[model samples]
Target: MALAKLKEAIGKEGFFLELDLADLKSVKQAAEEFLVTWEKLGEFTSYTCQWCHDSPLDQFTVQGYDLQFGTNTLGRYYFTMLLLPALQRTTGTNMTGKKARVINGSSIGHIDAPIEIPWNVLKAGSEDSKLKG
Candidate 1:
């Protein structure tokens, strides 16, 4: 659905790889699939995790890590590492001959994030979870 929208707006067919940032396995597969299709990465954009859980319960991703940490930290790190080679190939692959740069995007909401990681929150049903500011 998102690819269709992009195609309609750009008037050109594009590549799309299904990604679930919450799962490490999904991130690895997405990176692999993307590298298989594209030899070089001209531009790659990675954004911060935006999932917000308000159910009064600690949520865990399929990999058994905190949903947000798994998606925001683990998932992004793994995906970027796997794509490093493709990114490196950008030096002479693009018209501008520029190397690909990884961008860590964030929103204003980050200002309210805890200064330090609360270890207990990383596990599901860890009622002791408390975000330290």
Candidate 2:
């Protein structure tokens, strides 16, 4: 398994989750798995925010959200909420002796954000060309 191979190579505890943020189920499952596996976390989940230019049929998340927004925004948000308890447990235990910090790093995603709200793309089940959701 990928996790086994990663452990073999680095000898550190990690898990490989088939996480699909658009599918809230996957997000919840990933959180549950993490809670079972680890207790403390300095959380930094980097969700790559982008508006996909789907050249084919438009794609939407399993929960009928724009794939990009659902995964990049909602998915990570939900994941963090699920892990809040663990993060709280580790608060003030870190080397800095301060409370835990949750960092969501948005890397240059704003530049690519649509100039205007493409309502067709934003709404669930709305149709558009090449844009997912």
Candidate 3:
């Protein structure tokens, strides 16, 4: 449906990609492919991303890191880091030129529950009650 609508809307050829954001390897591969294609064509406009990792798992692990920190924050951070160069190239600017905005999909939950916890809770291996914030 989206493809048909896009074709109708554009009245020309359009490319669409499907991806799973939960997988780091997939994200990395997609970034690489985008770079290679952009390099070959020598034309790229901009890179945009909307990051949201609000799914709370009982316990999830990737590369031996906790899901909350790994998925909600760190993964997005690293993915942005890896793709910075390509994004810069896309916009025809160096790293220091324009600020590459990373719009985090932060929830009101953070503000709603303002009770501060110790930093160690974030670092501690145990996902205890105190760390549930």
Candidate 4:
């Protein structure tokens, strides 16, 4: 499988995490697992998060937000904030001879979204509003 190839490619240098961003519970569990696993590694150095949610809207999150916004925006924000302490720990220890870094990826199409977010629709999980790239 692709995961086996990735494990072979990284060898002993890194590991992969499996998480579902649309589900808050999954995100939280993944973060907890990462913390536990990395703590056993004895040091942390850097973290990279690459999340992209751009598909036809077909579901709503448990929190009543559109799937794309919930997963790509809110969920990613929550996950990153949760990991800050672990990232800070790495800097405190000078583990990699540098400060811990975080890299976030965004799509250029984001600029096309309306300046005023449809908060009401998002909060109410209303499908009346269509999302455009």
Which stretches of candidate 1 lie above 4 Å from their native place? 1-5, 51-57, 125-133
Per-residue lDDT value at 89 in model 4: 73
Q: Which pairs clash in model 3?
A: none
What would the per-residue lDDT of candidate 1 be over residues 50-77, giving only the tens digit for each residue?
5553422356679777777777788888
TM-score against truth, every candidate: 0.80, 0.71, 0.54, 0.72
**Which candidate comes out best when scored by lDDT?**
1
Residue by residue across 22-127, what tens digits does model 2's lDDT show? 8889999999998898888876566555554441235567887767777778888999999998999998898988887777776675665568856666446665
* lDDT head-to-head 2 vs 4, winner: 2
What is the overall TM-score of model 3 with all chains considered together?
Answer: 0.54
Q: Pick the candidate with the highest TM-score.
A: 1
Q: Is candidate 2 or candidate 3 better by lDDT?
A: 2
Q: How do these models rank on lDDT, best leading?
A: 1, 2, 4, 3
- Please report, in order, the local distance difference test score of every candidate based on alpha carbons: 0.77, 0.74, 0.51, 0.66
Which runs in model 2 stand beyond 4 Å of their true positions? 1-11, 53-57, 115-120, 126-133
RMSD of each: 3.2, 3.8, 6.1, 4.6
> Comparing candidate 1 with candidate 2, which one achieves the higher TM-score?
1
How would the candidate models be sorted by TM-score, starting from the highest?
1, 4, 2, 3
- In terms of lDDT, the poorest run of 10 residues in model 3 is 40-49
